[model samples]
Target chain A: MSAVVSLSNVHKSFGAVQVLRGVSFEVGPGEVVAVIGASGSGKSTALRCINALETVDSGEITVCGHKVHDPALDRRALRRDVGIVFQSYNLFPHLTVAQNIMLAPTCVKDMGKAEARKLAESVLARVGLSEKADNYPEQLSGGQQQRVAIARSLAMQPKLMLFDEVTSALDPQLTGEVLRVMEDLARGGMSMILVTHEMAFARKVASKVIFMHQGKVWETGPGAMLDDPQTQELREFLHNGL
Target chain B: MSYQFDFSALLPYWPVFLQGVWLTLKLSALATVFGFVVGTLCAIARADGPPWLKTVVAIYVETIRNTPLLVQIFLVYFGFASLGLKVTANTAAVAALVVNVGAYTCEIVRAGLESIHKSQLEAAECLGLTRTQTYWHVIVRPAIERVYPALTSQYVLLMLASSITSQISAEELTAVANRIQSDTFRSFETYIVTGALYIVLSFVVRAAFTLFGLVIFPRRRKLGTAI
Candidate 1:
């Protein structure tokens, strides 16, 4: 199959500040591509563009065969084929974990209540939170809430999953728990792309690593590229931990 | 010390006072229900309707909110009379109260609706919820839940303001009190009784609203306090 996602010479701006400038990359099926960069390096904006959350200025972005930059695109159809988990968890606080997981399935896919609950239960088990189905988002710990958010997206059965700094808000210990769930998903052969700052985690799990700096893709290679970065910027970024 | 108090003179008018209380309660109830409906609909339109529709709702809200409720009541009651409509005082009273309260309710509810964070709407969209689905589930219900107390207070104020309808001889509590005072010639005692009844009615409306909040938002108790 063609690349699951492709962006070529993409350009985006917020007023005078251009966030993404001439960015280009592609993700193959079942491949875990980790994008590592400093804050405000346009990594998050690129992920949002994939989900059609941000309209592009000029470029080509195709995700799951939907033209991301097209004005006539059916966003709901595109969203159905791709799922995204945000840094803040963003679970509906008013809803129980099971209801949050079942929301998309029942409302969008027209799944029956019993079937949706069964689906919710099964996904919750995958994330190791089956017992917390009835708990509200605010009642759970930060890591647990992030895991439930992943399960909410998983219930949609999207072909591609995007994670935008999902561990940014958690402490080191909590980050480990969320990472474990993600590693398991990667092992299960789910096509994924994640924007993350954890260099060790990216090297361990990402099949391909993309380094972005100053709104440009600075380097691209397999996970081993971190050990032998050809670009001086990547080496300096790794050394400074920025 | 110039005049003597005579509570005894108003004793036989208790039945008339009860009738006034009953009519006032009925009028208050009808206005509350319809006013809430009208206000919420207007709020939704102002928040998310098309530009022209939003403009229309804005004009209605500002027009009513800027004018005195008494003048609006007169416009509904006497204005309809001049038009050869001849609407009963009761009908005009409810209509006037509804139109007046609806504007205030619209402003209150619109504030609630705007308080919802933009990120919540983004999450709902990512979940593939249609526009209508997002509005009801993610925006309206949660917004209203967040602002339930504000709405309860607004409706209670509307109930008190219903007393103004008595000017048009709607036969509500104050109007009934007027007839009793005239018959018994005891204005002080009659007004004293009416004021106490108004206080009781306020408490009753508040308690009723608290119970209603409990019903529509059963999950609120589980997640947090009554708010």
Candidate 2:
């Protein structure tokens, strides 16, 4: 099967600082890829560049066969196919959970309100948040809000999902709940790229693990790489935590 | 030779004063509605439009805010007459009030729009919402909510400033008070009563806006807290 996402020689810089330098990776269909790195190691920027949220100064990013770096690519169309879950659950505070889920389908796809509502309800139920449909983001716990954010993306039926340290903002208990939902998504054949510090979850769910250090990929291999990293930086990173 | 306070002298003209108050409410209500519409549109342009549009809005806001409202009223009332527009004083007063308050509202609303988190816009994009949907759902609605208190305060100030229209003999509470004081020779007492009426009117406007906010942001009420 072909890769769902491909990043070739991706380079990005913000003013004088370079974030991602000559970074490259591929994620196959229905595969979960985990990116482990220290803060400011360019992992999150790499993920953001895949969706064109951050423009790459140079290089190619292809998601679901669409070239994201090309200015001619229909950005809204590209974004619809690749959903992103932020560290902070950024649900529309003014809208109910159901409304938040229904917004994209109805607005961008021109789906009818009733149809959108039905799809939203089913997706919310899939995330086990059916009862909180009418609740606002602030009314829910952090875990529930993150699940709702995941469901909001799922409502779009995206081809690929990018989790940018989604649980980093949550408490330990809330993080566990969110991770469980992510595991459920992975089991259901949803392709995902997760930038996370949860070594155990990365090991269990990731089909491939990548270690990024100093704006480049330092190591790439199966889940076992987390245990026996080849690079000194990766080994030191794993040892320091242990 | 002792001066006695006589409120009874004003009793006969109570009906006329009430009519003036009624007109004042009508004028302020119209100006506030029109001003809010203009202000909201200007704010959207300022926040999201191209640099040229933003610059134009900036100039309009600064010009209105820096100048005295009294001069603006005269500019609209007398300046328009000089230009041969021939509009009535009351119409000119309302027009001036709308233009003046619209600028201040634009600034307040723009700040609220700027306060929206960039993450919210990204979330809207990931949801595949159209540009218009993103604006209405993510930007405009919440921006308005965050600035509702400021908007109401400005509207109340606008109502109080309706007194300035009396300079051109446009019939309002202050104008009535001016005529009553001159006729009854009780300048101090007449202004005191009119000032009290204005205080009461400001309270009424604030209560109305509070109710309106409750209706518009039902989620805030249901959630039992603000985000």
Candidate 3:
């Protein structure tokens, strides 16, 4: 199977501080890649670069067959193929759940209201939020809000999804509900690159694991490699219980 | 000697006073709508447009905000005449009021725009929304909602300030009162009646804004809370 996302020797810097240096990774079709690392380890930056949220200073990054590093690239088309969810959920507080999910398809795809509403219903059902369609984001719990965020992204029918510490802000129980939704997405064969601290979920759901340390890919292999220490950094990171 | 109060003297001109009140409401409504549009566009330009546009909007906002509204009304009324452009007193009044209120509205809206989280823009961008689309759909309404109360208060002040337009003889409420007092030789009673009318007009304006806000921002209605 060919790769859906490919990043080779990607480098990025914000001001004088370099966030990503010579990072390389690939996510194949239907693959779930979990990137585990300490703060400032560049895992999240790498995910952002694939979505072209952060421009790479050097090297190539491609997503869904488009060269994201190319300045002439059709950025809107690339973005349509890539969906990203942040820890804050970022749902439009003024809109109801269905409106939030329907906004992109209607605006970007020019889908009609009836069609968008139908798509919204299916996506909300996928995220287990059918009953909250008319509710605002503030009315829902953190976990339900996150699920609504997930449904909003899923409504776009993206080729690949990026999750940036989506559960970091939630309690353990809330985190489990979000994780379950993500697990269902994985089971449905959606390609995903998740930057996470949930080691056990990564071990269980991630087909390939990339452990980053200090702005580079330090260790990488199957999920089981997390068990055997190919590098001391991965072992210490796992032992430290993040 | 005890002074006798005579509100009876002003009773004959009640129809004239009502006419003035009606004109004031109409003028205030026009100024409020156009001022809000101009101000919202200026806010967007200042917050996200090119550097040149930002500088231009900044100059407009600061110049209007720092100068007195009375001077602005004079400029709009007399400056046009000086330039050999003849405009009616009412047209000049409406133009002056819109411009004056627009500058204040721009600053209030700019604060609202700035308070939007960066992640909101990022999420909209990832959804393939163009900058304009993202702003209209995701950023503008919520920002406006967040600052609706501030906007409403600015407009209330704008309604009160319309009385200043009477100096140019716009035939609005205060101008009508000035005429009535002069004609009837009841300056004290006429002024008192005008003051009461102004108070009533403000309450009507406030109620209209409350109803309008509820319609435009239905989430506030549904949730009974600020978003």
Candidate 4:
């Protein structure tokens, strides 16, 4: 029940524009926190900052005991504890599904091929793509490819996983398959923080829901927050399909 | 007056021509292998290394790419002799070729590297892969695979350009042909045979690269899709 990720007064800017302006939130162990907002509301930027994909210009942020805001942070160690899935699925196109899943374990962890292959098999099964062990990324559907990407991240055995609008690129049917896999992960007690536009999935699956607007957390409560919003930004964001 | 064509006059020196063909193959093969390695490394350095290293690689790439291959061979051949390096003409030729092709390869591979989206590197980093590991597994290998066709074409062109090395007394295919023509006074026939050999050599080189591409990029072959 302890916090696995915590961000207090986080600020990040890209050149002239400030993407995240004093954003703050936290997620406890086995908690699914969904960040929903408009495109430029800094939801994705906040999520990226958790993995140190974007450095914080100010404020304190910690994930899995790593001080992400610190300049000399051991990023590699921090990354080892965090797995992030992108909207693009980012699978190594040259590698088969098993190879893509096995890549980090074998190369980073120095796991033997046999052991890595077994781990890949288990994770692929977890994503319900056990039959796609030998298929290339281009050979699979978008949903199936996204599932493989999830399995690829899962193969690293990360302490926390981040999903950045993973289903944003998929059709509704394809999105359902990917969402189902994520729902299973949530049900299995995986610590997850996702930036998503899927209000239904966020309301149904996220234990905590954060509504961001203009680079700050405008409203935060349980999944029921979507039903009754205190802030105008949250109400409008929920009313309009983003 | 109708001129009679006589390739028979040059048939006696088939073994000599074959030797030249073999040497040309060796020169091209050695250059391609070494150049690919050097060029891929340079591309990586140029794309992601430290600012100073990137600047150094940039200078190397621009210098080599802007100059002519013939000039590079002449410089390498004469420069080594001037410095008392004592390298043979073949060694000079290969060295020049490796240097020349390395630059072009660097540019081609760098283009491939640039085409990779930022999300891929972020994913690699989030998976806890080290910089070296990421470059090798995620960046360089896939970049090379994507640009394999361009690299292969550049190498084949380098093979054809090996003819230019004849000026430095490399004794490769063209030099051997020149010698045969001078000795037999059958200039047209000798050159016609040499031209045929060069064509055959080019096909052989292309086949070799195709076979290599199939082996190295198994996904490209198996999936029959763009990597």
Candidate 5:
């Protein structure tokens, strides 16, 4: 099967500091790939670069068969095919949850408000927040808001979804709720690239798990590699967290 | 010389003063609408335009903000005449107020726009929204909402400052008071009544904005929360 998303030898820098250096990864259709890393490991930057949120200094990133780094590619169209969920649920504060989900569909896809509303309602139901459609982001709990954020992405009907530590900002009880949503998405065969610190969730749901350290992928294998690691850095990092 | 406070003497001129108050309201309403549009556009250009455009907007904002409203009115009225652009005093007053308030509104709006998180822009981009869609949905609406309180206060202050335009003989409230005081020779009493009229007008403006905020931000009302 062809990979749904691919990043080859990507290099990214913010001023004098290099955030991503020679990092490479790929995710096939209907697969969940978790990128495990400590803070500042460039894991989030790599995912952001794939969506063109952060411009890669060099190398290739292809999402849904479109070359992301190429100047000729229509980034807006590419982004429509690949959705990203933020760590801090960045929903529009002034818009209702339903409007938040319907925004891209109506504005970008040229769907009518009625049609977008129908889709938003369905997605909100799918995420188990249909009743909160008229509510604002601040009114919902962190986990509920994150689920709304997920539904907002799904409403666009993206081929691949990027999760950049979606549950990191939540409390433990809330984290479980968000992780459960991701697990449900995975079971429903949504292709996802998750950059997470949730070791347990990574092992349970990810088909492939990657351990990144110091702006590079240090190890890659099945979920079991996290438990039976070949690298000292991964072991030490996991142990320290424990 | 015995000067007793006689509010009854001012009662006869109440109707005339009311008309002047009405004119002041109209002028302020027009100026606020036009000024807000100019301010919002200037802020957008300053924040997102090319470096030269940014510098131009910056200069306009800073120059207007730094100078006094009195000088700005004189410049708009007499300066335009010097350049051979003849206009009425009322038009000059309206134009001056718009220009003056537009600068302050630009700065307030720019601050709100800057407060939007970079992550929000990325999220909007990832949703496949076009630049314009992202701007309208994620940037402009939220920025305007965030700075709305400041905008309303500035507009109220603009209404009070409308009195300043009477210097150009615009026939607004202050001008009417001037005429009434000269006719009645009761300067203090006339001003006292005019000041009360202004207070009532400000309250009306505030109430109108509150209703407008309710209509514009229905999500906040529905959810009973702010973000």
Candidate 6:
């Protein structure tokens, strides 16, 4: 099976600190890959590089056929195929939930207003937020807002989604709400790469699990590999995270 | 000295005072609209334009902000004369006021643009919004909305400062008041009346701003809270 996303020996640094040191990974079509790591492990940086949010210092990243590492890469084209949701749930405060989802379709794709509104409605319904379409981001709870964020990304019909610590800011119950929505997407066979601290969610929903440490992919295997970690680093990480 | 105050002495010049008020309003309206447009463009340039453009906007903002409005008006009015141009005082006045207020509006708006979090911009980028679309929809529109109150305050001060153009002999409120005071010799009563009219004008302007805000920013109106 062909991979939808691939990275080979990607290197990135911030000033003097090297964040991603020769990291590599791949996500096949319909693969749900969970990247579990401690803080400062460069997992977020790798995910950001996939979306071209941060350029790789040295190496190759290809996402949905776009050569992300190329200097003349069409960034907007790359973005059209990839959707990203941040931990902050960065919804435009001035727009309603429906408008937030409709923005890109109308502006980038030039969809008609009625069509965009219908698309927004369907996506909001997917996240079970149909009633809150007219509500502003501030009016919703943290969980509802994150679901709306998911729906906003879904409006673009992106082939791949990137979730960067999306549940980190939420309480256990709110996190459960967001995780449930993500699990639904995974069950529906959407390709996703998520950086998470939730060991249990990663274990249940992820087809493959990767453990990143010291700016590299330290260990990778099926979800069951987490229970039988070969590296002492993964063992200690699972121990402390529990 | 017990001086008798007669406000009624200035009542005969009501028609003149009304015309002055109307002219002042027109000057302020034109300046406010053009100044805001210029300020918004300048704000966007300073924030993301090329280095040369940013430097040009910076110098303009600094130059106008540091100089006196009176002197700026004089320079604009007489500067055209020196160039052997036949510009009227009112034209010079509007040009000077727009230039002056545009600089201040640029600074106020740039602050609003900066206050937006980087994450918001990242989201816009992820959605594949072009630079113009991103700036208009996510950056400038919201930034201007955020700083609307400050912009309103600046515009009110601009209207008051329009009185300074009277020195150039523009036929605005203060100029009309100048003629009234000299002709009636009730300079004391004339100024008192004009000052009261100025107070009324500022209030009306503020009220209009509030109504305009209600129309444009549905989010603020719907939320029933300050943006």
Off by over 4 Å in 2: B183-189, B223-227
User: What lDDT tens digits, residue by residue, belong to model 3 across residues B71-91?
Assistant: 999999999999999899999
Least accurate stretch of 10 residues (summed lDDT) in model 5 chain B?
A: B218-227
Per-residue lDDT for A149-240 in model 1, tens only? 99999999999999999999999999999999999999999999999999999999999999999999999999999999999989999999
TM-score of chain A of each: 0.99, 0.97, 0.98, 0.98, 0.98, 0.99
- Model 6, span A1-242: residue lDDT tens: 77999999999999999999999889999999999999999999999999999999999999999999999999999999999999999999989999999999999999999999999999999999999999999999999999999999999999999999999999999999999999999999999999999999999999999999999999999999889999999999999987
Write candidate 4's Cα lDDT for A151-224 as tens digits. Answer: 99899888899999999999999999999999999999999999998988998999999988989998999998
Could you tell me the lDDT of residue B68 within candidate 5?
93
Write model 6 residue lDDT over B76-177, tens digit each, in one string.
998999999999999999999999999999999999999888898999999999988888888877888899999999999999999999999987999999
Q: For model 5, how does the per-residue alpha-carbon lDDT over A58-161 read when each residue is reduced to its tens digit?
A: 99988888998897888888878888898899998888899999998988889999999999999998888999998888889999999999999999898999
| Displacement of the residue B46 alpha carbon in candidate 4, Å | 2.2
Instruction: Please compute DockQ, using alpha carbons, for every candidate against the native two-chain complex.
Output: 0.77, 0.77, 0.91, 0.87, 0.81, 0.90
Ranking of all candidate structures by their DockQ, best first: 3, 6, 4, 5, 1, 2
lDDT ranking, high to low: 6, 3, 1, 4, 5, 2
- How large a fraction of the reference contact set does each model reproduce? 0.76, 0.89, 0.95, 0.95, 0.95, 0.86
> Where does model 5 exceed 4 Å of error?
B6-9, B223-227
Against the reference, the lDDT scores of all candidates come to: 0.92, 0.90, 0.93, 0.91, 0.91, 0.94
| Highest-DockQ candidate | 3
lDDT string for model 1 (B1-227, tens) is 68898888988888888898889889999998999899999999999889999999999998998899999999999889999997899999999999998998888889989998888888889989999998888888888888889988988888888899989999799999988888888999999999998988899999998887877875776765765
In order of appearance, the predictions have TM-scores of 0.95, 0.95, 0.98, 0.96, 0.96, 0.98
Interface RMSD of each: 0.8, 1.2, 0.7, 0.8, 1.1, 0.5
Question: Clashes in model 6: which pairs?
Answer: none
Count clashes in each candidate, considering only residues at least 3 apart in sequence or on different chains: 0, 0, 0, 0, 0, 0
Between candidates 5 and 6, the one scoring higher on TM-score is 6
Better of 2 and 6 by TM-score: 6
lDDT of 4: 0.91
| Leading candidate by lDDT | 6
| Local accuracy of candidate 3 as per-residue lDDT tens digits, A134-164 | 9999999999999999999999999999999
Clashes of 3: 0
